[model samples]
Target: MDTVKIRNKDMLWDIAADLHFPPGFDSKKKHPAIISVHPIGSCKEQTSGNVYGEALAKAGFVVLVFDASFQGASGGEPRFIEDPAQRVEDIRRVTDYLVTLPYVDEARIGTIGVCGGGTYAINAAMTERRIKAVVSITGVNFGRLSREAFSGYNPLGALEAMAQQRTSEARGGEVRVDNYLPCSVEAGRKAGLTDIDVLEATDYYRSPRGEKPHGATSGLFSHRAAAIGWDAFYLAEVLLTQPLLVVIGDKPGGFGAYRDGQEIYGRAASKQKELVVVEGASHYDLYDKPEPVAEALEKVVPFFTKHL
Candidate 1:
């Protein structure tokens, strides 16, 4: 594995990435490649690289796991921003870099997105034809999740607040950031956030189980408006024509990864698509739990093998 930096074309930021080569990798021969995208509030080292990226490389494919711009080790100002449009563009820019590599088979390039990264991957693949195959694992559509977060209450009220905050920051106000999950499981329980997914996310992200210095579970509040307005499956029925694989947990949490997986699987116009629901798994279970991760990769490795 080699640590590399990719230049984002639009923003000119350096996207920090880890390039993993397969065992006995040969530079003189072409090999299929996979771009493993980390979840929102997470970095390449957490799951995308340390888990799936490494596994996929051992399975005979080159894998590129990257930290999205503004998060992790990537170069960007106003750190921790999670702009949906920029996240989608990050995937495309990664593809741009991959295609330039002499050992990469550009036509066989594929992508795997975990949690919110799944949504971004699907969104990116809609217009980025270079991604021939897509795999979404426990993917959440942030737009729908945000709009319906509080039992369909006044979702726009937060949007209004975010808009105001963006303006304030533009005028030199202190930028505000918030944690994606509770700082700890006990804290989440105390805050009445007892959802299994919520608690597990806190445990995974906030504890040593999955914590990395760069995998900070925070995001700029002002930038959330972009995710609120973006839809991962928008026009997917017409434009998402590549072979797609969706691996999701059976448990439907407040984040709606399971629901979004089903919705996209039904909505995509892909001639070849499959949805694998891992029973007894929650949203966070697919993130790093051995059993669920193994199950997900069992399906994923074969799908990429056949498609990419």
Candidate 2:
């Protein structure tokens, strides 16, 4: 594995990434490649690089795991803004970088995204034809999640609040940011958040199990309006024609990854698509648990192997 910087042309910032080569890799021969995108509020070193990237590389593909622009080790000002459009473009930009490598087969390039990253990957593959295959693991359509959050009340009111905060920031108010999860599972329980996904996410991201200095799980509060207004599966019925794999846990949660996977499976225009529900698994369980992760990869590896 090699740490690398991918150039983001539109933002003029470098996307920090890790490039993993398969065992006995030969640069003289072109090999299929994959771009592993991290979850929102997470970095490459967590699931994208640490789990999927490493596993896929060992399975005989060149995998690149990257930090989205403005988060993690990537470069951007007004940090921690989770713009869905920019996140989609970041996948395309990573593809642009991958195709430049002599050892990469551009035609065989694929992508796998986890959590919010899965949604962005689906969004990106809609227009980015260079990506021949897509795998979305526990993908959450963030727009739907945001609008439905807090019991589906006052989405417009939340947008209005974001507008006010953005205006204040433009006028020199301090930029407001916050973590994506509670400090810990115990804290979340104390706060009355008993959702399995929420608690497991807190355990995975906020604990030593999956924690990294770059995986700060922070986001700009004002910029959330962008996500609330955007839909990751928009036009997927017409535009998403590539071979796709949607994986989700059986247990549903407030975050709605399971629903998103079901909707995408039904809506996508892909001639070849499959949805696998990992039994007894919740959203966060697919992120890192041994059995679930292995189960997911068993399907993912062959899907990409055949499609790419």
Candidate 3:
């Protein structure tokens, strides 16, 4: 396998990398392609994306993974924006890059998104006609999903406070950032703190499982910008015409999250939608664990082989 950097003039970022797989000696045809997108605040070195890219590449598919704009080596102003809309464009931009390569079979291009990337992939696939298939791992439905709004605060009061925050930000004020991962959950701690979220996500981002200190960030979005766009369940309502695959954990009932995927799948114009729930798996297990990772990829490769 080989890796190379791609300069995207559209996003004005030179932060994309493509991994190439050598075709078997008997085959002289262009190889299939897959793009793996990392989760929010994550770079291409992430375990979830790296394994998927390298594994797919060795399977004779060209895999490209990259850091989103403003994070890692990518160029962008005001780092750590964590803008959902921009991330979808990043994935679409990758598709734009892949089709230009001589070794890539343009017709056989698909995408795999893990966690936050799952939503971006779904959205991009909904908008971009070039994608034939897609897979989302533990994807979050940001727009519709009931989020932890500064707990105990009145909804109306919170909105009023947010209004003031926005007013301040509009006047050239710095945005307030929130760190979901606190290393430890403190006694009588901050509202909306959950051990499950902090522990699991922090383990991956802070440890070798998917660690990359070079390109790490946290919640830096303007409360106003994020709130204004909250209604757009991120391509959730958009109809997808391509065959789609969704993988999620089955044990201990994390399936509630899959409801977002189901909602989208139900609305899909395509007849080839599927959902697979892996046994004894959690959302984060697929991040690095080899057994589960292999199992998940086995399902994804065939989908691309037949479609991309």
Candidate 4:
């Protein structure tokens, strides 16, 4: 296993990535490689990112993992800004870096996007042709997420409202940001309705799950970005030719995302797309748990072995 910081000069943030591969793994032989992305508000230390990255490495894959811009050690001003467009671009940047390494097999590269990273991976797959096989684990439509959170309904109106809020913030004003936390713990509330969505987000983002709890408060008005993020359906409806895998769980919060991924998979031009749902897993459970995580690794190895 090896670790280093990679510099990215695209979009708002410069990336600092960590990569891991098998000891004495043959670089001359075209080997499978994975670019694993972290969940929203998560850094490279997020268990999902490294756990999966390390898992892939142990399985003989050269895995590259990194902190998303504005989140971890990656460089971006006004940190913790959650922009889907930039996040998607980050994956491509990592892919770009990976392709240049002598040890990497450019033709056999794959990607894994977890949580919000899942959406970014989908967007990257749509825009970046270099990605061969793509994995989306409990992904969501980022555009839909902002829309639902900001307004009760009316997607376009919500986007427009975001623009208005951006304008207001520019004018030296403030907007109430929702961090999704109950003022105090209550027993009956559904998990993750507070500052973030995933049930263990607080643990991963704010607790010691990672090396450092994010310095940025999960929510603050200073976090707004460009309106381009409002645009979803990164690519017009079409079949994605790359082999794709979708993993989800039966957790209450997991169903909707799995369904969304399925809908997109149906439109894929790629003949090799598969969906697997772990019956007892939750959205976060897939992030890091012995049983389901191994199952996820199991699903990917053969697929990449065959496709690559």
lDDT of 3 by residue, 1-308 (tens): 45566666764656656464645622356777788888766778775446777777767677788887777767776667666677877777778888887767888888888877776788888878788788887776554432333222244555566677767778988786655355434521454545454456666666566667744636553452453345324444446778888887653222234566666666666678888777777677777778777788878878777787
Q: Write the per-residue lDDT of candidate 1 for residues 82-135, one digit (tens) a residue.
A: 888989989989899999999999999999999999989999999999999999
Error of 2 at 229 (Å): 1.2
Expressed as tens digits, the lDDT of each residue in 179-224 for candidate 4 is: 6333223321454354323434445444454435543434433344
Candidate achieving higher TM-score, 1 or 2: 2
| CA-RMSD of model 4 | 3.6
Stretches of candidate 3 off by over 4 Å are 1-5, 18-28, 145-175, 184-195, 215-217, 227-238, 251-256
Model 3 clash count equals 1
Candidate 2 local lDDT, 155-216, one digit each (tens): 89988888998999999998999777899899999999888878888999888999999888
Model 2: per-residue Cα lDDT at residue 86: 91
What lDDT does model 1 reach?
Answer: 0.91
Task: Give the lDDT of residue 298 in candidate 1.
Answer: 96
User: C-alpha displacement of 106 in model 3, angstroms?
Assistant: 1.4
Give the residue spans of candidate 1 off by over 4 A: 8-10, 150-152
Q: Using TM-score as the measure, which candidate wins?
A: 2
Off by over 4 Å in 4: 8-13, 26-30, 154-161, 173-200, 203-212, 215-239
- Ten contiguous residues with the weakest lDDT in model 4: 180-189
- TM-score, every prediction: 0.97, 0.98, 0.83, 0.83
Clashing pairs in 1: none
